[model samples]
Target: MQEKLTINYTNDLHSYFENWPKIAGYLKGNKQKLQDAGETCWLVDIGDHVDRSRPIAEAFRGKANISLLNEAGYDFATIGNNEGITLDYDDLYHLYDEAEFRVAVANLHTKTGKDPSWMEPSWVVETTGGVKVGMIGLTAPFPDFYNLIGWDVQDPMEILKQEIGPLRSSCDVVVLLSHLGIYADRDIAAAFPEIDVIIGGHTHHLLHEGEYVNQCLITTAGKQGFYMGEVEIIWDTEQECITGKHARAIPVADLEDDADTAEQVAVYSENAAKAMHRPAVVLPDPMPCGPYEDSRAMDLLTDYLRRWTKADLAFLNAGVLLDSFPAGAVSYMDIHRICPHPINPATVPLTGESLEQIVNAALQPDFVSFPLKGFGFRGKVIGKMIYSGLTFDITGTEAKPVAKNLKIHGRPLDPKKLYTTAMADTFTFGSLLPNIKQAEGKKYFMPEMLRDLLLEAFQEIEK
Candidate 1:
């Protein structure tokens, strides 16, 4: 006799609740079909289901995501970088305290020596036909970011090595719910031949059909909820072993919304609108500026960020200000709406050599024009890197700097003097600013949104 089980999963939803009704409707319908046919099935999510981009997610701080997931009957899940690093310690600690399903991640540990009550390392579940399946979860290890949030993620492979041993020994088959993307998933499969399946996300690669690595099968449904992944496995009861496996990305774009969930979404949409209705900045007139050119408001902000950190200089992207403020009353909510990104200012110390590298890198068209989606950047593109305390000697068609003369309150560049620079955290790590990468001392300002500095800029400009 042969018994079969199916696992359905979604990942990287990122608070895209608009399409969620369709996803829920499709899942509910398919789950019923599977139940009616007497086939066993489970629904899971890899991670990144909560992002601050949506008003619901921002207002609830991830609890609302858990509520929606519970309503849809998710069986298992894991954490992604968004869930791991984006929230403060207490919020993330209790983010899923009320979850109805299992939340698994083997590598995370709280710095304060207390584990979240809702987290689990793994689980053992039995199918209707009595096949035992073991599942473990793992998240991406981003120490630099995670450490700031008071959480530490162990080496992914080390955790896997320790946890997979027990699951492999105890269960007929093993599965891993991975929020670590395709590269890590492939590594896991190659390292552990005992694991039968790997469901992946984070890099958001779409796998129409599952890929095979060593003795394991890997599948991903891409980002958002446009597609859900399905993995089917058959076990031979008589032989006490697995016989076959298959997986696919099932489209659910046109599916009808689940009636109850749809109503709930409508109510939430109204609430979200109310949440977005607060005033941000009171501009007396339209303070408009060009995309490529600098504005007084932007320059003021760059100056504020630099001076606030006592950095020698500052470089900020012009696109950080989403909309120009008309001169009047700006509220916290208005600031949020206008400059929605969660970016914060960071300061890094660099020598004259590294400073030149930073200026040269920011001058490149690619660095200025790159469209950045993640890293808490809710903006369109990086735009121009507005500078403070530095003047350029231009020699190119588009004001490209031939020589950058770094100064302090109008002094000449000193090659030996270490200069601190305040810039977006996005540029600090990537090649966008080569000097930033080479900088010796770096300090980060956290939990402070760029809009906060913008408000200060508004006040300074008004004065």
Candidate 2:
């Protein structure tokens, strides 16, 4: 006789709560139907459920996300880079304290070399019909940020190699909840034949019908809650092996909203509004700012970046400041509104030649106005480069500025000399600034975002 098991999964929700009600409703409905049919069904999330870009996530420190997941009935989950690196050590350590579901990221370990009480390497679930399913979780290893945040994220492949053997031996089928992106998922499927199903996220690629690699099935639901992924495995109980597998990405946009979840979201939003209303600093005057224009707010932020990183000089994009700060009392919400990116400050060693190239390239209209989506940037464009602890003469028209006499602390720039400069960590990746991306030495300051630095800068300016 053939028995079937259904696994419904979500990935990279990223705190996009708008579509969550539909997702909740759809999952709840389908889950109930499967349970009533006496079929084994599991709800899983592949990570990145919490993103600080949203006000609810920022104000509640991811606890609200946990609440939503709890209500949605997530059986198992992994960690994405956003959940691992965007939060502080204490925040992430206790993020799932109130979670009703189990988290199973095998690669994540504390600084003391111990796993959190909530984390398990793998979990085995037995269906009513005597089918044992083994589930393992893995996250992307971002060592630089993870190490700084008091966690050691071991290499995913190594962790998989160590954990998969035991799971394969003990269970009838093995499933991998991977937050390591689609490419890595495919690679893992090719490398490990023991893994029967791989549910993936992080790169936000949607697989409509799932892809078969070797004998393994790889599926993803894409980003946000636009689509929900479902995988069905047909087991031949008589033969004691899996017979077939099918996967689908179901669109939930047309699904009815769960009223209870909608109310919960509203309550969270109201609470977040009240929480973020607390005063952060008092400004003397409104700092007029724009993406292309020089502003007091951007200058102060750049200065703060240099001082905080202890770098000889600092450069920041004007667009990092989303809006001008008004005079009088500035609330934390105001700061969050102005600079909401979870970006960290980074100090990198750059040769004067590279620095000159970076500055010149930044001045170009095309580069400055380039709309960037990822790499920790929540802003719309790159904007003009703002500098602190350095000065350069502009020889071009007001519409465009050409760097002329570039100087560091009253001394002319030397092409051969290497200088330590502070800037947003966003430039360290991507081709936005090739000079910074290729920098040999880089030190990233985390846990404190640019908004945090702006708060400090505002307080100092007030004093």
The TM-score leader among the candidates is: 2
How many angstroms is residue 276 displaced in model 1 relative to the true structure, after the best TM-score fit? 3.8
Model 1 per-residue lDDT tens digits across residues 1-463:
9998989999999888888998888887788899899999899999999886667777778888898899998888998877887777888999999998899999999988889998889989999887889999999897766777788889989988888988888899999999998998998899899899999999889999999998799999988788889999999999999899999998877789898898887877677667766765466656765456688778878898888878778888887877776667766656666677767678888777777766776777777788877667778888877888887665555645545555656887777778877888877665655667766667777666577788887777666
lDDT tens digits by residue: candidate 2, 51-141: 9988999999999999999998888888888899999998988898898998989898999876668888789989768899999999999
Where's the lowest-lDDT run of ten residues in candidate 1?
A: 394-403
RMSD over all Cα atoms, model 1:
2.2
Backbone clashes, candidate 1: 15
Q: Superposing every Cα of model 2 onto the true structure, what RMSD results? A: 1.8
Candidate 1 Cα errors over 4 Å, as ranges: 331-333, 399-401, 438-440, 459-463
State in Å the error of residue 48, model 2. 1.0
